[model samples]
Target: MNLFAALPEKERLIAERFDSLIQDIKPLNSKQLAFLPRDIQRLSALLTAERSSLKAGYMNNAVMLSAYTRYFMRWNLFRLTSLFAGMDTTAFDFLKDGDYCLDIGSGPLTVPIALYLARPELRGKKLNWYCMDTSQNALALGENFFLSCAARLQTEEGEPAWRIVRVKGEMGTRIKNKVSFVSCANMFNELYWDTHNPLEKEAKKYAALLLSYTVPQKAVFVVEPGIPRAARFVSLLRSALIRSGMSILAPCPHEGACPMEGKKGGKWCHFILDTESAPKNLQALSEKAGLPKDRAALSFVFASSSPAHQSSSKPAGGKTAGKSAQGASRQHIRICSDPIVLPHGKTGRYACAHWGLTLVTGHRIKDTLSGDLLYADLSAQDIQALPVDRKSGAKIVNV
Candidate 1:
């Protein structure tokens, strides 16, 4: 189910509140509006090609900060919404009354705002939110935006049930209280950005740091841009976390090693969502800024410190132990890529199963998409009959 697709009303409400809050922050005149696009382009370059040139505390600049809030931050919120919508609700089951959530590198409280808008069940919970960031300015603005949005929906005397505590610090900043949920978005890439450190080493270092913020059985959510490097970083982090006894909850159905990792010039782990669902105003602003997006691409990991959930356990591999009258075993497979057209008019899609990378092919393959969980039954004879993909080395299964 597309969770975000079911929340049109909430999406509209968030976009409205965001527009009202941004307007109050900086009411742009005609000339300022014209210059906004240019500012957005400059900021994009700094965050991308010219990122190394970007110094610390760059958000301190009013113009750059404004551009970020209008363009990057808005789009990030949408991306989070799309990501959360795709995930299973069980992933967020750890969050409950009186729970504590620590959001790291929370510039303008984008994660918190996105949570409030996307996950309505979490809104009424008496949760403590510790939003940490290096830029005091962004934190302050984020607080106002969060409160404003919450106030509109909240009716009680105190308004929002979640308490917002802003902490101005960088990554690894300590929190005095124990947290049940830790969320970090668009922040990990900045750390060691210029370094040539091995990806595995970096993943291990950051995984330990992020896990330290949450207690056992709690969860940590990480989001990064869907670029190759970031996606590969997420894959490495998934492995490191699994080795540390953490169980991944979303985007992966099995706990086995990632097959997409270490494959040169091949597909990476990422998902894409169409941008047409975003607010019309935000979309228009993106076009004006010359950065219109047809799709929002992101790579994320949702993991728990506890053991793996039974539903996400490894699939039976060509075993007849659980076979039915059809002489095939049924197991859950996670679709990892869009449908691929093969010779002989066969449709194939990459998936993750207990046996490792698999090519699930059939006429019905086109009906499924990346990030989908499919249950298929295959016999041992069927599995032994096909050749592996030469480029990706995935096992082929025709259903």
Candidate 2:
């Protein structure tokens, strides 16, 4: 079953809303869109150029707006839908209490709409949503899309679905007050590669900015493309935030240093979710643009000011976690990376456990995938050794 199958009705509603949004755009037909063949070529070129410009921290908003309205808007809606659909909402259930959400670089209000649909309890709440963007056109388009969506739906309680406060500016020192949750998706990676600044300097700058913006016990979530560089940037940001007294909520299971950082060949952390269930209009756009729309691959970090939410206390299947070969309870090891196949048909994995970065190897571990809350029956010495076997002993417990 697809991830959203559990919430079939909501999934259908979200797809319908997305389809309505796309249909309203009235994409040109083949005869009328004879110019579209050229437009598509131009859009592809613009996207390529914009990517480089985006990395340099100099986005041409007018070009971006054109690209977005012409093609990427539907694509982004699909991306956001997949991301939000696959997410575990229990981690973000705290937002249902009328808390304020500040979405940095919230292009077209994707995060806000995704967040609302992901949490059923949040539907009728009177909440504050601040969308910070550098483009006035982007903000205007976002507000229009959201209002269009809200117009089609009715709340059972008859409350205004959401109140948006749009802020037009660069990310700076003007941290807003009472911002319960801060979301920055696909924004930090650009800032990380700002051509004028060194990467570490840029990462630290954004880290400090986020630290200053959010108060204690609140959460900040960042999402980026799943490529090695972007994923590594997310890891680096996670380390920076954790070192500054923040606790990681998902993706990482331990407070220890990221293993991928020191790996010489540039392996990084990222997750994948199927996006084949995207709205039909989005699928058509993807096909026309020659883009693979089947998968949503991205890296994200969920960090909170509260340390208690750092690690999972249990694993899948209700099994005892963190047991050692010596019969002692050690820290549970959660598999953080996809299993790496070794020469001897052995599978190796990098996991977050008590000893921080752990390398687990065994034939049985081949079945383990990322996001599995895992526990191994091995001593610290055993884990450090080569080719540890899960057949020797390991457990997967219910989280």
Candidate 3:
């Protein structure tokens, strides 16, 4: 039986609350953060642990972190590439009466949950969804969250919008359905660059295969970190889409070489920084991420194009080619008088506060490696059902 189906409506308010939190990237003040149930706070702490380097273990850290971090950390940085590449897929192009959609690297809400939020029009249609993810822990986090969230869907009428048929699989596998959209976000960087998972071969394999099955009305989005691999992927997808007669809806136009060239890829990327009180470790990581080491507050967008991606590859009276995209991206800003803040676990005075909190440690509380607190390394393999423990010990779950 579905666990959430048994809960009363009042018990399910977490989802709506979560949606609000993610939308504005607002952090909870000490007063607001204090209101969260202790259990949820603990959940955040456990899930927020850093353990991306540990591959041999249960990957328990990734699981809990994903379950905990309802969305990307509020202060997470954005570059031009990452911004558009990861531009919330749920927000646009969702069609009414659409038959099927495929979630490539669909970890948690990347598809189903987002579809429900972004596409109210699609609520009328029978949304048949297939979420393909490699991490069991991520899938687990997704399934449980979905179940919990479903219990709380307060509809204008009754019941929630969007019915999902989510499945756990990898991207290369053939999905025979005429996919309305295939969105793959920020995964290519990890796959081709970080893990080098031979996605190059896979891109041609499945993307082309899907295009072969569909007509011009269909679409597929290959989202990556705006690096070389991402650039290559986009270039490949563009070539593939052009070959298949599909048009570019977003990212305006490919401005330059996709930003993912050898060393330049990492340099062009940016990280969010609050220099006044950043932890030494986290600060070092930001610098390593190609951000300025000394700057206290910054937001960046990375793109790999060399202005070739602009609608005009040629410059306009020395105005430059990529300036329109640069201006367009800049004009769409996330400026808020009050930036979202989260507690750093240190009792210090900080301007921002967490709208929500997530526990994300991968190693057992007793394990020394659990001390590292990192995000972005989360996957399906790391999350587990949080069994009560003397301290939060890592639990190896069955996938």
Candidate 4:
């Protein structure tokens, strides 16, 4: 189920406001508009292939900043919206009426804007948002865009419930107050670019730094590109946080070591979301720039200082199923891969459980997708009867 599908009116409003904001920032002539696609392509290369050459202050360049807002920022917003929509509601329960949220590397206030659109219940909360970024220009532009969206969505007159505080710096910036939530989105890759340090060491260093900003009962969210390196980083970060006494809240059903980590052939953890519900103009712009996106893929980790809970017992789509029989063994498995076609008209998917990586195969597996939690009732005898795959050595269970 596409949770974003229900917000067509909200999506349209955001698209219209975003277009108007960009025009207001820089009114482009026909010639400039024609060259916008090329500019976007160049920026994309800097963010992907030539990322090592990118400087911390690259957003100071007007053309590059405008290109990012026009292309990358919009896509990121949609991606985050989809992520928040599919997440369990309890993950965000730490956000109360009076809480502070520190967003590190908050380029153009993407996280704030996404929260407003995806979580409507948060709109009325008297929350304080501290947006931190290296580029002052991006911070200012993001603040303007956030306010513009808020003005349109806010129905009751008086003052807006959310407050924005722009801090012009990167991670480790001195924040005076302890925050309840800390979010870092699409920024860690830039920080560790061109580094030769081991992923576990780097994850430990960064995890300690990020946790310093939060108080008790704190929550942290980190998102990165779905590429091999970034996903590996997320896996390592998950391990580091767990070692630091934090609980893994999403994407991982168990606190055990990641089975996909250090696997041969660069197997990493990541998930994909369909982009069909994205704005039409964004799709057209992507095609024009020769960068069509059928799906938005990312690797992320959500952790909390609170103890881990047994919330994965519920089935996918956030719905609870009836209780099992007295002696029936229940297992929660997190689907890690898309449906894999097997021989003889059967389907298979790689999953993660308390034991380790598992290969779940069955006749009818079309209903589940990547990043879904599959609840299975299997007894000890059922488990003992399953076969194992040779390549990955994962036990095969027919559901």
Candidate 5:
């Protein structure tokens, strides 16, 4: 039986809303939806105010709190709803019926909510769901709404169903200090730009934030907006975690240079018009798993010197994590391919998307806590192209 088969009817209902949101927005085909769910404007605004808030004190700043609150929840939702619908099963499949989880930038608790709703088996465990974000108001609203909405399931047969704490702070840093799994969704580029494009100091803060929150853990899942850079971002983060010595359990389904990153560049993110209009890459697969290629492509720039694993585990102190603290910090890259089948009678192989590539990295270290290789840093190798036409077999593996 599938793991999601035993969830509550209500939970399944809410999850369907997420699905509805995807269909309604139509981010893939719709020109308008393309660059949207725009959390950047909100991000920019929040960053500006956050700088101000610190001047006096966080206390009694209703205005700052208001903005902070909205920013946090909206950002969380913007980052993850798509992810929950896209992913089939993940590395954290081993989570107990109930366990502690950290949803970094947990847009409205998309990951945690979906996981709980989709898998009701986790109903009784003490789910100390940590919701960390820089928007305090966002966290407050999100937490309150969640508490109210989820109150019914808080307990079953006299046991606490879920205990969530929404903390308003930046991701990429420590919160509560420990966790089983940490989910960073749709905030990569934003945080990446923080160092320079968005604001250099913000960038460093984000990096430090992640490093602070990441190192000591069992499993950490890093998901980006399914844009051109999303895959690359995840790849780099995956490499870093692995280098830090974290065992990677369920990683993204894609194993290649994403389809969007050709010389011409490609679109970012995908949409679901309905169950009928899903991306072919997703439907044609053995399982409608992972962020599909037919979805908008995500691009990533590589760092040649250090492996993803090694770089990822680099401590916040600008220190590279040790093999003990950062298990996967060694240089071991993972190659991913979006396997496609060609037609016999037709001229070339049969794949829907225009182009695709595989993702590779360096560094391999067992996760310090879980003994998996996702606990450290990563260095990128390359995004080699797949040979096309019947004359060329997919050579994505060799690169």
Candidate 6:
């Protein structure tokens, strides 16, 4: 179900609140927004620049906040909230009502706001939320935005939805609470660039830190931009967590080493959220920003200290079995990259199956999309020896 389906009335109310919030911010006007395109272009350059060359001074500050509030907020809030909405709530089924949550780099409390909107069950529940950030201004602003959202979403006489703690400091400074849920969204890339630390070192450090704050059956979620570099970094982070004994919870059907690692620039794994039918305010913002309102993309990893209490096996027909998890009728593979349409009339799709990276090709594979959990029959030949042809070892199945 869609996020707003739980409380239909709140959809309009939330959209109205977004309009009011933006209007209330005096400097965030059409003229300011018009100028934001330039800032957005500059910010994009800064983000994709070489790590050592970055001006750490301008990374996170009042200036950046102004740009975000005026221009980036519309896209970021829309994208992130859509991502949160599309998440599998089963990943959070283990969390209890009163469990604590810690959101690192909680800029404007994006993840928390999305969580509440996506899971209305969280409303009227006493969940403690701790927001950690290095910028006091960001924390203050986030607090205001979060409270406004909560006030609008909460009904009269209902239990307070959350008990929030705003902590201003570098994230991962210490493990304050045994958090039941932890989210780090679009924060690691900045950490990597600002600190000049290798992705592996940073991933290892944060993996340990996140684990320290998490109890069994709890989860840690990380999301980055959908770019190839960011996707690869997330893959590295996921591998580190897996080696550290954490279990894959969402997205992936197997915990094997990511199939995209050894390959050099073949395909990257990421998810897409269709945002064409978003709320009125969001659509208006997209139109104003000269950006497409149809799709939002991101790469994310969700891992838990305990294995998901569900069947790992793929279902009957399109099931593609993997070597990692046994006792399944069908094998499963995660499509890591977009399909390549060969000039010879067959489509080529790169996938991560139980046997490792497999080049899936066939006449029936034309409709296969990236990020799909595909199933096929590969028992006839070894996955490693399969030829890159339409008649490749496996035939596409129902999945």
Question: For each candidate, what TM-score against the reference?
Answer: 0.90, 0.79, 0.46, 0.92, 0.49, 0.80
Model 2: per-residue Cα lDDT over 169-268, one tens digit each: 7677264566778888777755555367655566676888876666565888888877777877787788788878888777665667775552336456
Which regions of candidate 6 fall more than 4 Å away from where they truly are? 1-17, 25-34, 49-63, 194-198, 278-294, 309-328, 361-368, 377-399
Model 4, which residues run further than 4 Å from truth? 1-8, 15-17, 262-266, 308-326
For 1-399, candidate 1 gives per-residue lDDT tens digits of 221333458555666467667878666777877899999999999999999789789887788788889889999988887666545555566678988899999989999888887777778889999999989888888888888788776757686998989898998888888799888999989985676888789999998998888777688788889878888888998898888888877667677877766346967877767787787888988899889998887887778876544333333232111124357766567777667878887788887777778888765676665566666565666556556988678887655
**Candidate 2: RMSD to truth:** 4.9
Model 4 global lDDT (CA atoms, 0 to 1): 0.79
lDDT of 6 by residue, 210-261 (tens): 7777766677889888777778778888998889877876567688867665
Q: Which regions of candidate 3 fall more than 4 Å away from where they truly are?
A: 1-16, 19-94, 147-153, 174-176, 194-206, 209-216, 226-232, 254-399
Clashes of each: 0, 6, 58, 0, 94, 7
Summing lDDT over every window of 10 consecutive residues in candidate 4, give the lowest-scoring window. Answer: 312-321
Please list the C-alpha lDDT of all candidates, in the order they appear.
0.77, 0.61, 0.37, 0.79, 0.39, 0.65
Candidate 1 clashes between residue pairs 3 or more apart in a chain or in different chains? none
**Candidate 4: deviation at residue 77, Å?**
0.7
Positional deviation of residue 248's Cα in model 4 after best superposition, in angstroms? 1.6
Q: Tell me the tens digit of each residue's lDDT in model 5 across 18-123.
A: 4333333222344422322243233344444443334323322543343333333333332243333332333234455445677776644556655554444555
Q: How would you encode candidate 4's per-residue C-alpha lDDT over 148-199 as one tens digit per residue?
A: 7787787888667999999989899998788999999998898676788877
What's the true lDDT of residue 395 in model 2?
26
Displacement of residue 27 (Cα, Å) in model 1 is 3.3
Q: Give the range of the ten consecutive residues with the poorest summed lDDT in model 5.
A: 364-373
Give the top-scoring candidate (TM-score). 4
Of 3 and 4, the candidate ahead on lDDT is 4
Superposed by TM-score, candidate 2 places the C-alpha of residue 29 at a distance from the truth, in angstroms, of 8.0
- On TM-score, the stronger of 3 and 5 is 5
